[model samples]
Target: MALMITDECINCDVCEPECPNSAISQGAEIYEIDPNLCTECVGHYDEPQCQQVCPVDCIPHNPDMKETKEELYQKYMIISAA
Candidate 1:
């Protein structure tokens, strides 16, 4: 599943750099995670870097965008293939 940032974010910008896929970005007020770019670090790291560092713990799975590990890996592969 792709991780999402809730309104709890402080716009601290901490999670942005932590994302290996460069999935996280600054929105008008809070940060946003791009589903196409988010692999939950499947190809880059052992875990979701953003979730690991977010102080507010606002990063969590998007139930609507849920996917299994294989799907996540395929998504990562698709991006890397490009």
Candidate 2:
């Protein structure tokens, strides 16, 4: 599944650079994750890089955008090829 930044985000600007797919960005309020560009690091790492580096643990799976690992991998492939 893709990940999302919650309101709990501190806006420390740490998670943005950690995203392999560049899915994280500063929203009107806190940081936001783009479900279309998020692949949960499927093609880049064993784990989600943003989750690992977030100091407040505000990032979590986007329940509304649930997706299988295979689907994430496919998205990663498309992202990588582009």
Candidate 3:
């Protein structure tokens, strides 16, 4: 599944650079994760880098944008090709 940044985000800049897909960005409020560009770091890391580096642990799986691991890998391949 893709990940999302909740309101709990402290606006700490750490997670943005840690995202391999460049999916994290500063939204109107906190940092946001674009589901279209997010592959849960499947093609780059074993786990979500953003979650690891986030000081407040505000990143979590996006229940509304769920996808299997294989699907995530496919998304990763498509993104990498671009």
Candidate number of the best lDDT: 2
Clashing pairs in 2: none
Instruction: Give the runs in model 1 whose Cα sits over 4 Å from its true position.
Output: none
- Model 2 scores worst on lDDT over the 10 consecutive residues at 17-26
lDDT of candidates 1 onward, in order:
0.91, 0.94, 0.93
Candidate 1 overall lDDT versus native? 0.91
lDDT by residue for model 1 (8-36), tens: 99999899998878899999899999998
Candidates in descending lDDT order: 2, 3, 1
Prediction RMSDs, each to the true structure: 0.8, 0.5, 0.5
Selected candidate, larger lDDT, 1 vs 2: 2
Deviating ranges (above 4 Å) for candidate 2: none
State the displacement of the C-alpha of residue 32, model 3, in Å, after optimal TM-score superposition: 0.1
> TM-scores, in order shown?
0.95, 0.97, 0.97
- lDDT by residue (1-82, candidate 2, tens digit) is 9999999999999999999899998999999999999999998999999999999999999999989999999999999999
Candidate 1 displacement at residue 74 in angstroms: 0.5
lDDT for 39 in candidate 1 is: 94
